[model samples]
Target: MGDVRAPVAGLPPVAALVLAAGGGRRLGGRPKALLAYRGRPLLEHAVAVVRGGGCAPVHVVLGAERERVAATAELAGCAVVANPDWASGLGSSLRAGLASLPPGCSAALVALVDTPGVTPAAVARLLAAHRAGAALAAACYGGGRGHPVLIGARYFGEAAAGARGDTGARALLAARAGELVLVECGDVAAPDDVDTPQDWARWSGQPGQPGWPGSLGQSG
Candidate 1:
């Protein structure tokens, strides 16, 4: 695979909130974000996609494997924020990452650490739609919505404040359905997340699949 370089267009100054606080119970206590596929931690691949998509000031929320997560973030050259309330669920981590965003960010690109397949192109597409005035834009594949959803500044407060327990921005998106824009992507990678060992195995076999790491079996 090519070097994980920033995009030539240079990502906008939007902040990215990478949710990496989940305890990988399904994977036998293995931190899902730290799981390797194609020779790189899932979190590292996820961060590379965000960086390649032209988003800046990326912040990763660490919880279950805080040290490992923080180390990955440091290696990626992105900021790391601890989500002490991670046991409460994804919403809390989302809130923590959002709160850590630097001042003046007009929008945020949110991605899950376990979702390493979400592509930089899909993320850039979401950013384009958001910049084009969509209140919320998500990447869709095979008729299924997926990660790296872009939320404009208009709903930042609502997303950050309305989230509770494990209830995330889904509620906000449902409440503002009329303002949502779904961008169709031919790549199934956007919708594929490594939740179990089975998922990792299946995705590993499909390295050519869109949204997945280009170097499926290469060590980073």
Candidate 2:
């Protein structure tokens, strides 16, 4: 909620809001944000993706291991918003993230930490859609929709109010289906979630493969 990094001029400035607060109950109580990926925390990777995709002054919503993540991850330029009620679900994180954005932002490109498979290209697609003037938009994988939904400044309040529990922004997206822009990202990305042990095993690298850190102790 503090002052955000001043955005560059001319180009439309979009703030990247990363929802990394989930407790990862299904993943054996591990904070999904702290989960290791390619020698860094999953939360860090999510932040990088958003930045690479052209979002300015990224904001990350942290819940589980809020302190540990701060001590460990390299969040130099990001604004970290800790949600004490993170146990409530993605809804709380979503609301907290939206509220934390500073004034003068043009839009919010919401991303999730658990989604490593979501590429920067997918995020760029959402940014493109937003530039085209879509009030609401989301990345669509194959026949279904997925993460990193774009909420323009006009609908920030309504979207935050409607995001409830584990549903996140699903309810809002459904209600605005007629106006929502679905950018197909299946060809360039996979919307697989690291919500289970098996899911982690696949994305976190195999034994000896360059993936998650060998020891979790380095996390803080």
Candidate 3:
């Protein structure tokens, strides 16, 4: 297995694809990127996570209220791409993000903004797990696999082709399971996401309510 390890060194630059383009159909049309969290926009946190996870030249996909998000959110140092077809599904955003990588980028660490439970530690583990130059790696919580998937440059075309609808690289991961590397991150982070109103309430700091301060998976 080529001594699978964390914190791959002397490797080509790894760019981050932070998929923040969701229209938030489940949240009554509110854009997930603009959602309030930790005194800043959710997209800001996602970008910080990507940068903190040891990736460079982070690319963010914006949709729905793209203009508002661009204007209000602190997206400095990130390459923002607007996905007009964002409503089509997560696949389109994934494709757009992948296509926007800077020249010479060898791999893309894909992450979702909705998954507030994911932390930079999980990302570091997945980055460390990349075996060959162009290998597949993903994070796992307990027994189930979760987001922030790693797609080597060699598989970018195939991964982008399979990226349709809400299934972002899952089809590829399922078919290439034999070649995939699963990094167990259950101890360092949570893989759950803030998808529903109940989740929002749980994270919301209300009187007499046990709020999840930094519970959306902040770096410890």
Candidate 4:
């Protein structure tokens, strides 16, 4: 809601690859990214977080609800890239996003549409780790690794070289664990992702409920 700018230091010309190509079967075939939460679409929150993280040239991969998602993304000032192989799974979307990154991107910050609670600080920490020469960086909360992962250009070819079935960068990161950095984030909301109506209800804190983070305040 305010003027968003890239972080001044410890952040390179990073591109954000937001994966929103899922079919959302658990959401009754509805596009999860378009689902409303706290007066805004879930995808919009994800985009805001990425932009707040100081990533430039954000590319959103759309498939299940292409037209609707693209229009929403365009309104949010994000570029949309179609993922025809979305039926194949997340790997296809990831590959498409990677291929769409700008030519001079020094690194990429990847986020999932369903994981709307990831914070800008968490993303910034990942970028800081990557800029410090880590091949791979991820946000970790209470020892569990979470979303909005960062991958350096050093592994760009390796990530893009994989088959379209790969859903995550696990293999690539595992092979280079010695160079991986983990930023410990105490916020549980950073890993919260919506999959079912129950999940949404819980996150939104319907009337008598208490949600993760106890209360939703500014997460930056």
Q: How well is each residue in 163-206 modelled by candidate 3, as lDDT tens digits?
A: 99989898889889988888898998788787665666555442
The positional error of residue 197 in candidate 2, measured at the CA in angstroms, is 0.5
lDDT of candidate 4 over 1-220, digit per residue (tens): 3334585654458889988888777655777777766666677778888887788878898999698766653335678889988988787887888888878788889899888678777777777676677768888888877777788887887876653574567667677778778878656345888777567666665432333221122121
Clashes of each: 2, 0, 1, 0
Off by over 4 Å in 1: 1-12, 72-74, 205-220
Candidate 3: where is the Cα deviation over 4 Å?
Answer: 1-10, 131-134, 206-220
Top-TM-score structure, candidate number: 2
How many clashes show up in model 1? 2
Candidate 4 least-lDDT 10 residues: 211-220
The full ranking of all candidates by lDDT, starting with the best, is 2, 3, 4, 1
Quote each prediction's TM-score.
0.84, 0.89, 0.87, 0.85
Candidate 1, 105-147: lDDT as tens digits: 7788899877766777777777778667776887888766666
Which model, 3 or 4, shows the larger lDDT?
A: 3
Name the 10 consecutive residues with the lowest summed lDDT in model 1.
Answer: 208-217
lDDT at position 138, candidate 3: 88
Cα deviation at 77, candidate 2, in Å, is 0.2
In order, the Cα lDDT scores of the candidates are: 0.73, 0.81, 0.79, 0.73
Displacement of the residue 57 alpha carbon in candidate 1, Å? 1.3
Model 2, residue 220: displacement in angstroms?
A: 17
Q: Is candidate 2 or 3 superior in lDDT?
A: 2
